[model samples]
Target: MPLSPAFSSILEKEYEINFTQCLPSGRLKYTELCNLLQLTAATHADLGGISFTDMQEFNQAWVLSRMRIEIKALPQWKDIVTVKTWINTLENSRSIRALEIYLNGEKIIGGETFWAVFNTVKRRPEALALGHKHFELYPDLKATKESFSKIIINPEKEEVFEKKVILSDLDIINHVNHVKYLEWCMDVVDEKIILNQKIKSFEMNFMKELSLRDQVVIHENLSDNSIVFSITKENKNCFALQLNLV
Candidate 1:
């Protein structure tokens, strides 16, 4: 299918990033960055997607699946940064998009998001080909496979999660956002824990949706610097997160 005109026009939207948003460690906080990215995506919907052009006549929303955020230096609250985003492709019911977060002339962050547009009435995925007028403006899109490794959790190490679940860990989805769960998993690994000294990659299999009031157990272990992570509730596997900590 051809690219949507709406997609191309949204690339012109203005975006700003602040330096004060950085954490005590001098890096951008995880959730803050995620929220900004969400905002950026929302703006694109307004300017590009046909779903929003019709307003009340057409009701739709995008759901995020996989996302990768990389930053050499995170901008704080006061630091000014410009962001440019583009829709890349739609294949097999998935849409891939690229976003560049820059600080001054320096490129600080380069990220990509995996999304699927859902029809409000049907509550299911929508076909990008049906977006006739939407493709005229968004012409510069090339489909490409995402570059990242998948991480797997080790079952033996997961026994550690026999503990209780607390209310603080829950989120709007009733389940925790994957990144927050990652933040928790990452905290368990210390500098001295691995001799391999490098994180190659990680992956998550969201087998079951997590909801509020549901008990959760965090299971983890260090495997030569690469830690395996898994979250369970009542012996049923809810989520599995893997980290390649080199």
Candidate 2:
């Protein structure tokens, strides 16, 4: 596995899981799990921002297209586990992001993901040529056509909520981690609704950078039992997420 130009640095974390599906006596909180995932995501993404050539006018962001997570074990609340992830490669312009979860140095679960890069102003995938200048900084990553786009659902009107960027979310990279954003947005979701039904799949799109003092407005849209969660910064759509809950 050779690295890609987009795969600039390594992102790793220690995650403790204290809940799972096996227990029914007490209770389970999906918000907690969603928060953990966001933390893990933030760990990996903060690493991606490192090799940037210029940050003044131009910045790059990743939106997840598809994900495959195979769990060999589940950790309860407060249990500490470790997570490691990176840009495995680039399929055309799409980046393949992968993660591994470990407990006491033993492999527990693994995750694989796909992503696309969006140019902030244009609000779309940045052309390879347009990004070539910064690409030079990541001479190792390759540009490709295989980068698949994440699925998204738009609604006529969205249910909105506001959240603050608290101190607990700062990663080693001086910004909010990826999983933190997910957890923040998912926190308001009614668990009875998410757990009662089965989710077929999910997609996450990261559009902007979040740091201290940032206030995010989370927007959720539900249709026929399916749902999409979009987070905004000062009104610009940053993350467009979709879930299939049946």
Candidate 3:
């Protein structure tokens, strides 16, 4: 696909929050908020001629490596929110992108994402085959106050639950969707915290991809202000999530 005439380095798109995307409190669910940000980033890439369809021609696709999200507020059901996204850096097989969500012209959430180009057929990381120089980069512009960080897994973490990857967990890439990992960890969290909007920020790191029928165990490490969850398969770490409570 060619770059759209309306293409811009930074893109903003509006979404109407529906009841299905909200929590019992009518505020948007964290997973749904991530979906909106992902959608906006995809839209921007599509318009810039570097979308999944464009990269698929060369057996390549972008995969999330790490993500950091800071939230001041969550939109409620029936609210109209705008998501803005832009590339902070792009080189070789890796890129950094920033995204933000605004309600009534006030920014409420910001996200920093690290992505890597992967060979879908070969199932390995590789440099992107498509040209991306046409899209301007903003190395100095950042959406979140903090950049991406490594989420340290505690060796003393206790196993909380186990799950098998199912059809619902897979995305277009045939692996577990990144957001599903967050949902899994959230399930074990206190409902009162989520219902009362007590989450201030969170981070997720994807270490290995999980496929259908793959069984995994989730572990938890609790602290005074943060809770860390690590998922493992056959004693090997696959993913980690750290939730910073307000």
Candidate 4:
């Protein structure tokens, strides 16, 4: 079957869920799903000529500002799945990208992300377009169902846990991997809360990067049907996350 035009300029890649990427239950882990999404995003950007290497000429690099994902089911170990991604829109400094995971031709996971180009030297966000160099490669695609705005929630004052960064948490970029932030949030959340509810959606924002020297304080609030996590290091907010469950 053919996909809709709104998902055009889409880059599709196949991946096998390896044993290492799965949990003890033989299901694909959430962190591994996040890794797949990161890889897919990079590949799509490369195909669009907006890859990290391509942006280097302009002293810029892409950074994920916010991302939201919804998982319907997780593929088991050794399952072959396809990851599809495309650019949704580009406006000034920010662009929206959507990704979906399909197993046996059935959609299982879907997500949307907001990204911005960072000026390496200035240490600030740079407009995605410089003069005529706009990233409108797939401007007509409309893959996301939600707006690209940041998620907002009020966190409780007390912290659930304080975690020290270990070497395993760092990625090639020298800072803790964005996926690790989500893992940390999950670690501090009550197991009963997780097992009792079905996670419908996830939203996270990266405010600041955390490194090996940083000690993170995690705060969590469990409402009736939602959970919010806030991470801070040295009194500065690093990440804010929300999980909606049914």
Ranked candidates (lDDT, high to low): 3, 4, 1, 2
Q: What TM-score would every model get versus the actual structure? A: 0.66, 0.52, 0.99, 0.84
Model 3 residue pairs with clashes: none
| Poorest lDDT segment (10 consecutive residues) of candidate 1 | 136-145
Could you tell me how far off, in angstroms, the CA of residue 76 lies in candidate 3 after the best superposition? 0.5
Candidate 3 ranges beyond 4 A from true positions: none
Give the TM-score comparing model 2 with the true structure, all chains together: 0.52
Predicted candidate 3 versus true structure: per-residue lDDT over 123-159, tens digit per residue: 9999988888888999999999988777989999999
lDDT for residue 180 in candidate 4, whole number 0-100: 92
Lowest lDDT sum, 10 consecutive residues, model 4, at 1-10
Q: State the lDDT of candidate 2 residue by residue for 1-246, as single tens digits.
A: 123444535556775555462133222243344455545665444444422233213554454545544444455555677776655665444666666667788875555666665554554666332232222223233222123345564656475778788788875445665666666656666666544434434446666667788988888887885677888888787677666565
Query: Higher-lDDT candidate among 1 and 3?
Result: 3
Runs with alpha carbons beyond 4 Å of true place in candidate 1: 1-20, 50-60, 118-146, 159-207, 233-246
In model 3, how large is the Cα lDDT of residue 18? 100
Compared with the true structure, the alpha-carbon lDDT of candidate 2 equals 0.56
Q: Judge candidate 1 against the unseen true structure and give its global Cα lDDT, from 0 to 1.
A: 0.57
Residue 41 in model 2: shift from native, Å?
A: 10
lDDT of 1 at 242: 55
Candidate 4 Cα errors over 4 Å, as ranges: 1-8, 129-144, 148-150, 155-157, 191-197
